[model samples]
Target: VVPGINEIYDPRTKTWSEGPERYFPTYPALFLTQGGEIFYTGSNAGYGPADEGREPGLWDLESNTFTEVGGLRDADQLETSASLLLPPAQEQRFMVLGGGGVGESEESTERTAIIDLTEENPRYRDGPPLPQGTRYLSSVILPDDTVFTSGGSEDYRGRGDSDILKAQFYDPATNSFRPAADPTVGRNYHSEALLLPDGRVATFGSDPLFGDADNTRMGEFEKRIEVYTPPYLHDGREERRPVLGEGPERAAPGETVTFATGQPGRIAEARLMRPSAVTHTTDVEQRSLQLEVRRGAGGVSFTLPEDPSLVPPGWYMLFVSDEEGTPSEATWIQIGEGLAKD
Candidate 1:
């Protein structure tokens, strides 16, 4: 209902400052693009004009410009949808998941779209579709560079018992979906999935309107929690998982930090995934940045990207993935203006 109004908060100053006169829908799915620009995936939740500010695009706050990106299927049904910055954030790729019709309509779509912003002219391209039409789905970026998505409803607020229990992993490398263990409970409306530091994904909260298909029975908030363990942790691989030891507690951008790993030779890649801050399936901060790894006999070294814009000052989880794409349990690394512990 509000437009041309925005605010920015400074944690250090503990004060709110006036931001650029740009407006966004509630919980807009925006990723911080390079040079202080923001990319909106057009995935959103809650209410507004339903027409205004609904297109996917690169939003430049400095000059007050919006360059729209095309090629999204079911663009009108983006409400309750999910958007994610694809793994290895340097690729600058993003995806929008399934969503429902505008303003309480029962319609939904099983479509997905991906956009690579690195290209000269970035546009959304159709990726693999979901198994069924869903809304309010929750997604978590796994440590192994795959996205674990699960749980949504076919209708708004899971009306008509439309909650979907399907779960799948989307691999960016292959652009395909792999079957994952189905969640026991149906999740719709208020739900979220998060990646744990131990490499497991934890799911929480789902509020359905009704318990049954007829919508006769009143619904209750699901209090139980579920955790998903990816395949990398199993199959006799526990002993072989790369371990990060003796790393700095804090380091500045453009600094090289070394960690002791037993099997440095098998380390194919390392990444720093910003600790996620999400609400209602909208996570603008959830992104992964690949670190250039140099192997040493008993450890490995990761040089943080020189650009502070690429890596905002915050806490991140550093995971080293082996040749088999198996990631180690995360080690905490803080990026800021600080010296490392000798």
Candidate 2:
């Protein structure tokens, strides 16, 4: 229904504008890169050999055109696959993780791929795979720069019997994955996970259709929300979260930004987290980047990334954290052109 007709809504004018035709019918696995370009990796437009030609593509917001970038390593990963824009790096990379194949009994794939967006001809290469094949999982980036993937099904429509309980942490530094603490609830289709300001992750929702029906142990939908406290919070140390005070409401790239903090000595990290836009196991806009923090006279100072591609021109929630991984209350700041010059 989407590729057939595309429309853009303007909040200021409160009007809708018809856009160019889409390259393909996109689904949940759509993400926005640091360069302000949109990319699509997956879709729910049925499955078969015909889908092999369905490759990933990029959308130019200004020109209202879609261009095919590169094809996935495994074409079967075109549905229910989780896609995310990796944290700010020298080269922009987008990752696509586990998802089901074409059939109900078909096993899910643990294979993953990373597309280098910085390249003039972007293409995907083999990346680190998951610990195991999973679909419908919630992936959230921790403040420590690790990706945390939680509950999902091991097989398609197998949530009743193949619910994954344990969580996994993907370390980009080593290009490997390790297990993390498990949550009580089994989050599959329709579930989501988000990073909190305090460095903890909150997971919510589950397949209510099966949960509400079939009054059985396995078929019940999960209505209760679960919060996961990372290992940093309970490392047998006193909790000391940085308290952010006055700071500029807007900033520019390469600018030296200062903020007042009551616990300057405890301030060890500063970061910018883009607001989350999640639905159906897909969240393209959820990204976090570390800022260089230095102790100053009355507070702390940090330089924003010099590259606009790293910190795209938009609004971001700035947070300061201590050594124990406790983050301060988020302060909204506008970067680049969204705000007027002072």
Q: Against the unseen true structure, what C-alpha lDDT does each candidate score?
A: 0.86, 0.72
TM-score list, all predictions: 0.95, 0.83
List model 1 lDDT by residue over 66-158, tens digit each: 999998989999989999999888888999999988778899999988999989999999999999998988888887789999998899889
What are the per-residue Cα lDDT tens digits for candidate 2 across 1-342? 544466777766999998665544345465656666677766442333434435678878788777776656666655667777776443467778877765454467777777888787987787887777877778887766778888877766444467678798877778788889988887776788988766678999877334432336546566899999877666553255567888888888778788887767888888788877777777867878778799977789878776676776788888777876666767788888344323
Model 2, which residues run further than 4 Å from truth? 43-53, 61-71, 89-91, 103-105, 208-218, 249-256, 263-266, 303-315, 322-326, 334-342
* lDDT over C-alpha atoms for residue 322 of model 2: 81
Residue 216, candidate 1: how far off, in angstroms? 2.0
- Predicted model with the maximum TM-score: 1
Instruction: Show pairs that collide, candidate 2.
Output: 211-220, 211-221
Off by over 4 Å in 1: 1-4, 338-342
